[model samples]
Target: MGNFLCSSSVGRKLIMSLSGCFLVLFLIFHMSMNIAAIFSEDAYNMICAFLGANWYALVATVILAGGVIVHLVYAVLLTLQNRKARGAQRYAVTVKEEGVAWSSKNMLLIGFIVVLGLLLHLYNFWYHMQLQELLGNHTNDFGYSPADGVSLIRDLFAQPVFCVIYLVWFAAIWFHLTHGVWSMFQSVGFANATWYPRLKLISNIMATIIFLGFAVVVVVFYIKSICPACCVA
Candidate 1:
């Protein structure tokens, strides 16, 4: 098993698929949590407080980070192997119009965009919240308590530019996940002709649900802030 994971292409792809699936589930949970902030700041803050500076959350974070690292490293290795295998013949292949051709070809680009967005998000939220809690600062930009996730999100989205940027990032994430969710299954050999369409449909539904959950939070908060009397009671 260890040798297969370290040396086999199929094993590496399996690991990627497993990690990718776990991350997708995490994204769904995260988006749901963020969406709660739009409806009630206190609820969000409670969640932040619950998750903050805790040993369990820290352990989960470390495991998630390790999964990301392993997935990315294997992805690079797979790409390199693919490139070497296609050497001198890589560009000579005819463009084939197969199902999901476009997404398969652009997976790496989508992955890159997702990674970039995650970095920006970590800086904006995680660094301010969990990291600050771990560091014992416990105060955020709006002078609200670090556990006051409502204030953090509201203040961030109140800025027009940041809201727009966040929306854009969400859009990228939507696209990435739309492709990634199905592709992960495909990599694991579940995307046969009989199941391909169903898999794609499921992937699209999951992606849309996650995207709208996060997007609604940002859009609703931005609108509420702009028209406080109409929104805030």
Candidate 2:
């Protein structure tokens, strides 16, 4: 079983599908947490405190990191394998293929953008908060407590440049998810004549929901930063 999984094409895709699904669930949970900050900073901070540098959170973080690594590795391997199989034919295609989503064609490019965004996010939040906590520092370099997610959000989003960058990142993630979600199901043997369109629709809806969920937090915080009186009143 292990050899098959490591050596077979179908088995490799199965791995990607499983890891992709795991990451999608994490995205949903993260979006929910970000939404909480919009409603109540106190509640959001409390939640962050519970999760910050704790044993369970750390364990989950390690596992989530593993999933991300596995997903990325498999995606790259699959792309290379496909390109090798196609040979020069890959470049010979001049006309756009019918029924194929543009996102489906450019997933690797979009995924690269998503990864860049993830690195920025890690440096901004995780490095500041959880890493500080692990290093025995109560407060981050920004002069706020490590778990003070609300303040961090406010400080970062207050800069219009970061706001634009994050929004663009979210859009890239949206593009990645649209094809990824459908591919996840397809890899698991769900593709068929009747279910193709349905799966595409489902993937689009899930991607849009996640996109809106994360985008709303950034948009709301940016607005509050510029118009403090507007949010308070």
Candidate 3:
């Protein structure tokens, strides 16, 4: 069974699907954390401090990183394997297939964008706060307390360029999730003739919800930065 999972195509996909699902769950949690910032910076920072450099949080972070690595590695392997299997036929098919979403066809490209965005996010947030804390720093490079997530968010999104870049990143994630969510279930044999459409709809809804949840926080913070006095009241 272990060899089958490690060596077979179906096994590789199953591993990828499971890891993707795990990451999606983490996204929901992270999105919820961002949403909390919109309501109360104190509350958000409390959450961040609770999760920063703590044993459990470190363990969770390691697990999350593992999931990300596994998912990306398998995605690349499967894409290459599929292309090899298709050979010249891959280029020969010029017409669009019914029910094949554009995201499904261009997932690898979108995945790269998603990864680049993820790296930017980690550098901006994780490196500043948790990594600093782990390194025994009391404050980040910006001089804000490592746990001061609200200030970080305010500073990062206050810039117009960052706001635009993050919005674009969110769109890339939406594209990835539109196909990925349902595909996760499909890999586990949960998708079929009766359930495919339903799963697709669910995936779209989930993607949109996550996109809006994170985007709203960025937009709101940018607005607040523009009119601090108005926001205070």
Candidate 4:
């Protein structure tokens, strides 16, 4: 079954679409969770504790990792196949904007940047917090409890360099989603002309909401770090 599913162009796209949808669901939950931090530290930490090293959280993490790996692998495979089919014409393109967005043309490059951002995020939070708990360490390397993720986020974003990097990461995500969301719909047979523009609009809305939600946490925490006297949490 696995061989049959991955041995054809349509199967490859179907796999990508399914994995992309799963990831989109995860992103929505994650974006909502980040926004919770702006409302209350204790509330956010409660969520962190709930998702910490538990059986369910572990399961979810593994599933999320699988989705990421499969999506990235299939994307690379499909791009290589397309390039092979296009031959020299792949590089012989003359004047883009014939129709597709630039993001569609450079999705692989954008995906690479997104992966870099993910690594930075995992280093900052996952390793320090979840990995510590999984390893049975009561306190993280930062000398804080594994459950003290709020402080981790605050400290990471306090650094101007990390803050700027995260914002740039968010920008890349925005571009990727604007193209990806609509394309996924089209891939799965929603390519009817009447719904095309509407899907594009929906894609943009989703991308903006996700970017703003995640960005708010980073920007807010960074501001509070610089001026604890006045800024709200």
Candidate 5:
């Protein structure tokens, strides 16, 4: 079955859709977890600690990594196939694709930016946090416990540059998810004329929620760090 799937175009797309769905769910959970920090530092840190360096967490991380790799690999394969099939079309005067969103056309580019952002994010958070704990360092270079996500957030967002970068990354995520969510359903055969619009609506709503949720975390922490008087009573 696995070999057959890899050999066929449809099977590879199905695999991409499945893995993409898995990662989408994880993003929702991750955004929710970060939202907890806005209301309660203890709750956020507690959740962070709960998910750090433990066997279950490690297993989940590995699975998540596998999904990302699979999705990316299939994406490249699809792009190459399309280019090869449409080699002549590349030079023809392109007619605009009516009703298709801009994101749909540029998914590959958006996906690449998203991947780069994820790498930067991992370097900023995962390496300093969970990876530290996994390596038996109770505290990071800043002397805060590796599980001390509150401290990490405060210090990291203190720099306006990083805040801006994160906001830009989140914007890229918005574009990616808007197309990705509905497109995944379409790939799995849910894109009939009637259902396509509805799925697109749902996709926009989800993409907005995720972007706003993540942006809030970065912006709020940055504000707090920049102006203690505004945050502190």
Candidate 6:
């Protein structure tokens, strides 16, 4: 079992699927919270306070970080192993492209782009919010306090450049998830002939929902920033 997990393609893909599914759940929770920020600042801040550097939340954060690290490491390892197995024939052409799409062929590149976006997101929000709270500095730029997540989000999205960058990052994430969600299931033996199309459709719907949920918050907040008079009485 140990050797299989360490050295086998199927085992690595299984790990990737499990970790990817875990992250998807996390994204759903996060997007829901972000959507709250759009309706009520106090409610959003309250949610943030609940998740504030408390023991359980911190532990969950650590576990989530570990999952991301493990998934990324295994992805790189598997890609390298596959490349080595293919040797000089890595670029050989194949007429049998019926089962493969562009994304399946470029998962690594999409994964890298997704990782880069995640790093930027972590720096913009996590470092300032949770990490600061953990270190006991609970006040941010607006003086609203560390877990004042609504304020932090509003401030960040108010900047035009940052808003544009975040939009781009979210776009990359959407593309990554569109392929990843179903592919994970396919890896775990759930994508037989009858199930493949259904799973792909479900994946697209899930990806679209997540992307729009996140995008709406960013775009709405940005618009609010630009036209505060329009939102206020």
Candidate 1, residue 216: lDDT: 87
RMSD of candidates 1 onward, in order: 2.0, 1.4, 1.4, 1.5, 1.6, 2.1
Total backbone collisions for each predicted model: 0, 0, 0, 0, 0, 1
Pull out the clashing pairs in model 4.
Answer: none
Candidate 3: list runs displaced more than 4 Å: 88-93, 230-233
Query: In model 4, where is the ten-residue run with the lowest total lDDT?
Result: 88-97
Models 1 onward score TM values of 0.91, 0.96, 0.96, 0.95, 0.94, 0.92
Write the residue-wise lDDT of candidate 4 on 1-233 in tens digits: 78856897877888888898888889999999988888899999999999999999999999999999999999898899988887864554588757779998998899999999999899999999889999999999889889888999888989999999999999999999999998888888977889999999999999999899999899899989999865675
* Backbone clashes in model 2: 0
For model 2, residues 1-233, the per-residue Cα lDDT tens digits are: 58867699989989999999999999999999999998899999998898899999999999999999998998899999999897965554487788878898998899899999999999999999999999999889888999999999999999999999999999998999999998999998989989988988999999999999999999899999999876751
lDDT of 3: 0.92
- State which candidate, 1 or 4, has the greater lDDT: 4
Q: After superposition, how far is residue 230 of candidate 3 from its true place, in Å?
A: 4.2
Ranking by lDDT: 3, 2, 4, 5, 6, 1
Q: Using alpha carbons, what is the TM-score of model 5?
A: 0.94
> Which has the higher TM-score value, candidate number 5 or candidate number 6?
5
**Candidate 5 Cα misplacement greater than 4 A, ranges:** none
Q: Residue 5 in model 2: shift from native, Å?
A: 1.6
Q: At residue 220, give the lDDT of candidate 1.
A: 84
lDDT of 2: 0.92
TM-score of 4: 0.95
Which pairs clash in model 6?
Answer: 138-146
